[model samples]
Target: MRVLLVAYGSRGDVEPMVGFAVQLRALGAEVQMCAPPDFAELLEGVGIPLAPIGQPVRPVVKGVVTGTAPMPAEGLPQRAAALVATTYDAVAAVAEGFDAVVATGLLPAAAGARSVAEKLGILYSFVAYFPTYLPSPHHPPFERPGRPFPPEVTDNRALWELDFETMNVLFGTGLNTHRASIGLPPVDDFRGYVLTGRPWLATDPALSPWPEPADIDVVQTGAWFRPDERPLPADLVAFLEGGPVPVYVGFGSIPVRDSADVARAAIEAVRAHGRRVIVSGGWADLDLIDDQGDCLAVGEVNHHVLFRRVAAVVHHGGAGTTTTAARAGAPQVVVPQMADQPYWAGRVADLGIGAAHDGPTPTFESLVAALETALAPETAARAAALSGMVRTDGATAAAKLLFDAVLTAEPQQ
Candidate 1:
């Protein structure tokens, strides 16, 4: 079977798919991932074969905060022709000849998958990294602007319910109006557009429910790990072995408003509690002051590989990261910066596997307190128990779902 894995966004989004890809290959399935252009080498370097696509998705979420395009319209269909003109060629390039196409992130890839799969008569499935399948029905809204929602709307469900007028504004008279200049037919929603999975609903497994019927095959596969994880970094391995188990502090792809402040506070907390620190800066840099001698600031460490030896894991609550930490048997302290972070924060705290620093990440005192709980003996024991229980064959589960539910379904065409 040929599996076409389509993903966008940063390393956090693309890396987990690698786990699935590696597992699929072992099962005699040909798996190829098409990610942002910049990830091409990193994927190759890690020995995971990939098909490169479009520009890199830089800190676009940060772009929204930085006042770039009103919000996270960094690369989306907000301006009608914006998506059509840019994504048509991209969709046209990688859309053909796959048993199934799976994607994540915003509308372009999902829409593109639908369009291309329809034309090729293949299956399309979307895998959400977090639960944005629909707007939060039971919580305060993220007032962030330029969300996939159009300018004319207020309530999330209203924007989701695109009326005919909104459709006209969206699609206009032509399928690819701007493409006419380059000579191409206009396009509309592509094909088999299903947001097939919701991994985190406000961090509560129960809340992540989809309003859409189960007909679309939107099932959670839990978190997956690649069969081909790189051996742990020499430095990380030595550090873990050399010291008392440290609390791991790092945000994944998402950034905080103040990295320095976060680092300082984390270092202080570590000293106060008499513990070493392993900071995985991830995309952000965390070079501490000379005074922070014991707090090791760093970047680009894989959680699956790093969490096994760490005592307590503290981080921004990306589903993949949190899940890996849990599976590794490490208690966590979550300082959710935005979106699903808060949700996961609550779940971890409630589950007794970790603690949450609600909203804007609470004060340093809260973080210190949460870390104390995370580092406690009982918390460590619970996390260790959870590690043994997760059945994290995410890759296998997803592959099974695709083969049985999607690829085997009647062709979309």
Candidate 2:
């Protein structure tokens, strides 16, 4: 069988799909990817064939983080239309002869790929990394740019109704335009069409559970990730062995303004607790505070190895990072920036594995307080206990499911 995995957005969005692709290949299926060009290097490293789609995401992300881009209301509709066209063109060009197309990432891109799958009469599945993306009475929908739920609305069901309408307003036109061009019908319920009735939820049930008595029949697959096999760098090894384990801080692909100030605050907070610091210079470009041996700034290292050696993980509360830290038995302090991050932060605190900082920009005091809680012996004990419960076979599980679905759909000779 041949599979085309389509994902677009930042590393957080693309990496999980790559993990699933690896598992599919392991099952003797040919796999390819359609994603942003920014991740070409990462895909190449893993040996997955890449059919690059959309623009390089780094500059766009930096612009948004630095407040240099147009507001969502000003440019979103145009950009959404263009992305739909681009994604459809890219996927349609290379999706032929593939048995299935699995899509996860930005809704527009997913919609485009799903449309292609519809035209070809092949299997298409949409997988969400968090439960909030799926409609349920348990939680409200994620706020879209330029669209916020009315203050008077307190019920979850009502909020979801509004969310579906908002999705139509923002993306329905562009999506329908492309669908019509491809001889497909217009999608009235745009969000429902993309998510499908039986969408897959690829999250650890222990970390992010699907609330019961919900609307949809969700297939809750455990979180999908390839186990990191890279050895730690020699210099990082030296840092880990240099002293008591240090607090590990990183924002991954989420950019922040004034990263230097953020770095200084984090260092001060960690030092106040009498611990060393390891800073990851992600897209934020965070650097070490000074010529101090107690602190180290690194780029792109194995979290699987590093998290196990950390005193605590302080990060932007991305789903992938949260799961990594949880799996490594490291306590966490989640400082959420935007879009489902706050949800992950809440899950960390609720699980008793970490502390959830109140907001995105962490002050010296906030970091100190959160770190104090995260560094507690009780928190570490809980984190270690939770590590054993996190499943390591989510990607393999998803791959087998996809394989069976394809085989069952094939016409018998």
Candidate 3:
């Protein structure tokens, strides 16, 4: 009953897998998490056995997202490809001694884990938190700015096909190199290169509706939420009670060139509406000046408890944050920066639960308007309504499926 969960990226990407591992353990399975060194302590604290793989690629990935550093000519994708290449050997080495390999859909980690599982003949599965991995007419890939296509265009699947082809064109050289190292043939179809027959869609059906008559063996489980809620800090509790309900602001672990500017903009935008603010300095390294009377800027706090007390949530629209806000029934202001963020932002607006501001870096006035719109009573009601429909036991459902897959794959004793 031992399993290996391979995940990478920042807290948003890693935390959900930890929650998934916890559920597997509750079902009487031994779970070992393969992740970056940044999460070593967090995994250990949760009592999950750690199988550290991959270097700290978070900074490099952040650089790609924020344009903060000088990269090779291929820009961010090349740097990401290089980072994944460096970790492939490490990922393959640690994947041994596990009954099943459940890989999160980070390009680097998933590709490496899939390669090892195939070579070893072990049961393999994948987790796609967002819709990026699926080539469906319902949505385009996350990196694309917006879904400007008409239904005819989207339904034709032209964009989906193009995205797959483009990925291969962009990263195929490095991917082919790794495939050769692993003694596997070069991929003929980029869409199927990193996918397995059984892949778990780790998002709530209510939020990201499952496409009907799916082409792949995809499981539309609800979002993998942490099973337990941490206690709120006394000072935070006092702050929440002291004044008007504050807007919760954070970008999770995504980096920005100048976080101070972003934070200042967030504070001012919310303050324009006479609302207090609680800002999370998540991996953005946001260093704020004094909170003054209307703002409380600090390091991370437990979102499960904090989001419930907030008037509205303003964030970068990561899959993890989007789901957390939905579960807490907090109206959201999504200011997407890069990758799948814009997709989630658009989704919030489509659902009528919140507002989405375009551009990687939104202006102060745009943020102010988005936040104001998000706090509208109708939007709050819509968010609350959706929250009630969101299933929170995604970990348990996913664990059951993985266990079944393991049983199905294992030879007779």
Q: In model 1, what lDDT does residue 209 have?
A: 34
What's the best-to-worst order under lDDT? 2, 3, 1
Q: Tell me the lDDT of candidate 1.
A: 0.63
Write the residue-wise lDDT of candidate 2 on 57-94 in tens digits: 88888888778874567577778888898999999999
> All models: lDDT?
0.63, 0.90, 0.77
Q: What is the clash count for each candidate, in the order shown? A: 10, 0, 0
True lDDT of residue 78, candidate 2: 76
Which pairs of residues clash in candidate 1, taking residues 3 or more apart in a chain or in different chains? Answer: 19-226, 114-190, 114-191, 115-190, 115-191, 175-186, 175-187, 176-186, 202-343, 203-343
Q: Which stretches of candidate 1 lie above 4 Å from their native place?
A: 46-49, 65-81, 131-217, 291-293, 361-363, 405-409
The most accurate candidate by lDDT is 2
Where model 3 places Cα greater than 4 Å from the true spot, the runs are 73-85, 142-156, 410-413
Which stretches of model 2 miss by more than 4 angstroms? 410-413
Q: RMSD in angstroms, all models? A: 4.9, 2.0, 3.3
lDDT of 1 at 94: 60
